[model samples]
Target: MSLAPILLFTYNRPEHTQAVLDSLSKNKEAIDSVLYIFCDGLKENSSEENKSKNKLVQQIISSENRFKEVKITIQTKNKGLARSIIDGLNTVFLEHEKLIVLEDDLILSPFFLAYMNDSLNRYKDFKNVGEIGSCNFFACGKEFPTYFFTNMPDTWGWGTWKDRWNKFNEDAVFLYKELEKNNKMHAFNTYGAYDMEGMLKDQIFGKVDSWAIRWQAVMVLNNWLCLYPNPSYSNHIESINATHAKINMVPPLQNNEPTFETIEIKELKNVTEAMQLGYSGKGDYFGKLSKKYLKKKTKKILKSVLLFPLPYGIVAFFKKNKPKK
Candidate 1:
């Protein structure tokens, strides 16, 4: 079977870029599979240190020849991570029907490429299968199947066909309105286990710029299922400078090749419950309390502090000694 093209997005993280590249190059299919590197340009007012790092990243990419074909696109202007990914996907879909994607901070197992290619080929024509996710964050028991389906799409390491990606809607306003109007917010949040709805709202309000949230919104709206491997074929590496500061529990990488099978598209209750529990702050006392009450109360207090005309000294003291509860 033909291998799907791999697209790697990078910015100013040279060390991370090199690490991920080395890991991906170890894949059995790396020698024959085509690879594309999209290096985003430095932002406006970027410091010289950042410029140096970006240049180092480009240099590393340019010197790489591990793949059968290596294509590089160094942007002249900053497009941010969101725009860069959207544009990169569009550009690749023009030539290839499907492709795998990875960010600069992800490490892939040797069998990652094999699993992705197999799944892509198996589900290429299945309209219900929107994408193949390589990372499984959900805590599953040993009896859980090798693979399962969910409405949520993971971005850490994933692949999708042009047809499925073509339906991706980036309009945050439209997606929010539709979900709210249809009363699908609960399902969209994975039954209140996650703050996906809040993330979408943040995207709409300009508080955060996230392409993954928008992509998930599309998947949720269309009732599309993303296939996830049990022992995740990929894992994310946390970086101090990364946008997502929350550290995720990386599952053990798949040690051997997994067999792919055509299965009915449906969410597994056990897997769903596991995912909800994982995100619902079950074992942590502070997590449950914060999610259930502290967050809302804190937000209200902050709003009052910002809007109320209070003495400067008093406000400063209040902020300095903010209650930890």
Candidate 2:
């Protein structure tokens, strides 16, 4: 079997870059696989501290030679995470039909490469299989099969074919319009388990710049399924300097080799239900209501206060000036 090329994206997090690299180098197929490292350039007028950290990260990747082949691309200008990933994937896919991807903040198990290669090879011919992912955020329990399918794609540690990746539509406006036109917003949000629609809007409105959300939109719109190992093969170690603030308590990485099989393309019902409940919220009725509904309402109220502050300021002044009863 031809091992898929591994693409690693890094920025100024030296410790994260080094830790992920060390864990990846220990994978069983690391010696046989090709590794491509993309070091995004520093932003304009970057602080000296950031520049030094970026240089350290570059130095770390320069000395690495554990893979069958090592290729490095150091951008002279910052392309941001979205542009960096899209551009990097485009470049690698030109030579390889399929490849595995890793960011700077994930630790992989020794069997991570083996599982990715096996699944990628197994599902390469299946048009409906959009991605082979190693990060399973929800705990579906031991009853779940060795591997199952989900409508959402996981980018932490994933593999995909060039053909499928080509279908990724980065146009936030187009994606949002299509989802609304088709009345698939509810389904796109994993039955209200997540707020993917809001994220898509954030992307559209320039509130956030996230490639993963766009990628997820692509999968959801196409009705594609991403395969995930029961016991995830990757662990996301949240960094102090991480871009996003979502902290997930990922299940422990699978220490032993994982078993993969060719399952039907349909998503496992039990697993999907579990994911819905898990992502809906933390606790009971109030938790769900607060997360699913009140959060958005609160954001609107805050935005209103920020936008029209004079009236709110007057009220605040009067309340403060009024005697404390």
C-alpha local distance difference test of each model: 0.86, 0.86
Off by over 4 Å in 1: 283-325
Provide backbone clash counts, one per model: 0, 0
Worst window of 10 by summed lDDT in candidate 1: 283-292
TM-score of 2: 0.85
Q: Which segments of candidate 2 are over 4 A away from where they belong?
A: 283-325
TM-score of decoy 1? 0.85
lDDT of 2: 0.86
Query: TM-score for all predictions?
Result: 0.85, 0.85
> How big is the RMSD of model 2?
8.8
For model 1, how does the per-residue alpha-carbon lDDT over 62-130 read when each residue is reduced to its tens digit?
A: 999999999999999999999999999999999999999999988889889989999999998888889
